[model samples]
Target: MIMPNEQKAPLVHLANAIGTMSEVSSRVGQYVLANPEKVVHQTVAELAEYTHSGQASVLRLCRQLGFKGFSEFKLALMAELAASERSTATDSDNEADRYGALLKRLTQSMQKTAYALHAEQLLAIAVHMVKARRISVFGSGISGLVSQLVSYRLMRLGLPAQAFQDPVLAHEVMTDVDKHCVALGISESGVTLDTVEFLKRARTAGAKTIAITGRVNSPVAQAADLVLLAVPIEPLTIGGDISPAISKIYLVELLAMAIADLSHAGRQRNERSKTP
Candidate 1:
C-alpha cells in the first residue's frame, strides 16, 4: 500500500473509492468498508480468500489507500474503529451500503462506455454481427475470461459466437474465417500480441474484424475493420484488473442489445410485408 494517509483516513478513503476499484480491489474494499472491525482481526490471506480476491489485491488495496501493507492498513482501521462511535447500522445496512456503492460504480462505468462509443458505430457493427454466418472472439488471461462472457451473451441472443483463449486454437479456427464471418478481439491495451495477431489473421482470411480496446492507434485496432473504444476505467468489476474488463463487458452488453433490436425490427418488417 503506497498511497499514504492519516489514521482516520482508512475507512474514509475506502468508502469513497470502493465504487471505482477493480473487481478484486473492489471486493476487498467493499468488505473492509462494511466490516473494518472484522478485517482488523483477520490475516491478509484470510480476508483475501474470504473475499475471493488474492492476497496481492488486498495488499494493493491497502497500498493504494496509503498503507504500507495490510499490517498498517489494519492498524489504521483499528484506530478508525476505536475513534468512531458504536454504530446502530445493522449488518443488512452495511451490506446494502457496500452493494449500493458497487452498483453506482458499475452504473457510472456503463454510462461512460455508452458516451465514448457512438450509437451509430455500435449499430453499424451490430448489423454485421446479426448477419454474420459465425463470430469468433479472441482474448487472453482475464481478457480470455471476458471473451467467454462476450460469446455467451451473443450466443444467448441466438448468434453463433465462440471465444478463444489460446492463440494456437484461435489460429486453427481463424483458418475457417470468411467474408461472412465476424472476428472480434478484446484487449485493454489494444497491443496484446496474440489477440492482435488473431484479429489480423482473421482479417486476412476475409472476415470483418472488430476490436474492443483503449487505444485507436493500437495494433489490434489497426487490424480491425471497426473499433469499439473500451472506456479506460479503474476500480474493479468487469475490469482486467476487473475494472478494465468491466468496460469491455459493458460494450458487449450494448452490442447484444443492439443486435436484439435490429433482429426485432427486421422481423417486424418481414411480418408487415407478409400481412399486406
Candidate 2:
C-alpha cells in the first residue's frame, strides 16, 4: 500500500517543476494516460475535477507535457481525432461516398489548421492584454466575429476592450485610443482595407498595436507592434468558409483563457499587497 507521503511526492514534484514532463508528472498524467480517449473532449476544469486535482494543477501538467497550455493540448487531441476519422468511417460503401469523403477531408484540414496554431504567440497576446490600458479589436467578415469574442472575453477579465467591426467606428476608435493603449486587429487575409487603415492610425496615435491574422506578411501585420499568425486554411469550395471561421474562433478562445489566467494572477498579487 502507498503511504500518504508517497502519494504526496508526485503531486509535490509536479507542483515544483511542472514545467517539464518526461512520461510522468503526477496522478493527472497517469489519469490521462489511462483515459486517452476522454482527454480529447475534456476541459481543464473537467480534467481537474476528474483527477481530483486543482485546475491550476491540470494547467501545470499540460505545461509539463510541453504544451503552451490546456487549449493546445486539446487541439492536439482533436488532430488525433481527425487522423482517425472516427466520425466518418462507416460500412456504407454507397453512391454518397464522395460526399462523405469530402466532409472528412474538410474536417481533417480544419483540425490540422487548429493544431498548427502557435501557442507562444497567443500567450504573448495575453501578456499584452494584461498590461494595456485600453484595447481596440478590429476585423471584417467572419474574423469580425472572432474580434467580438476576444473583446467580450477581455472585458470579463476587467480589461478595457472594444470590438469595432464597422469601418467608421474602427477609424474613430483608432483616432481616440490613448497613447498607452493597445489595439488588436484580427483578419484572416490581413489586408482588409479598413483593418489595415485602423491599425496604421492606432500606431500613428502611439498606441501599441497587435494584429492577429493568418497572413503575417500582410499590411496590417506590417503596421502593428506585434503580430500573432494563425495557420491559413481556406475552404476548397465556395460555400465552405466555415472552417476558417471556426479556427479563428478557437484561436480567440485560447487567447481569452490565457488572459484570464494572467488576470487572476494579478488579482492575487493585489490582494496580497492589501494584507497588512
Cα lDDT tens digits, model 2, 1-276, are 223233322222222332234322444653553344567688888888766678988787766545667886666655554544543454135659757665665554345444444456567778877888888888888888888888887788788898888989889877677777899888776778888898889889988888877654467777787765454542233543645566566667777789888878888999999999
Which pairs, if any, clash in model 2? none
| Model 2 regions more than 4 Å off | 1-120, 234-240
Q: 99 in model 2: Cα distance from truth in Å?
A: 8.0
TM-score of each: 0.61, 0.59
Estimate candidate 1's alpha-carbon lDDT, on a 0 to 1 scale. 0.76
Runs of candidate 1 with Cα error greater than 4 angstroms are 1-108, 235-240
* Top model number, TM-score: 1
* Window of ten residues with lowest summed lDDT in model 2: 6-15
Provide the lDDT at 194 for model 1: 96
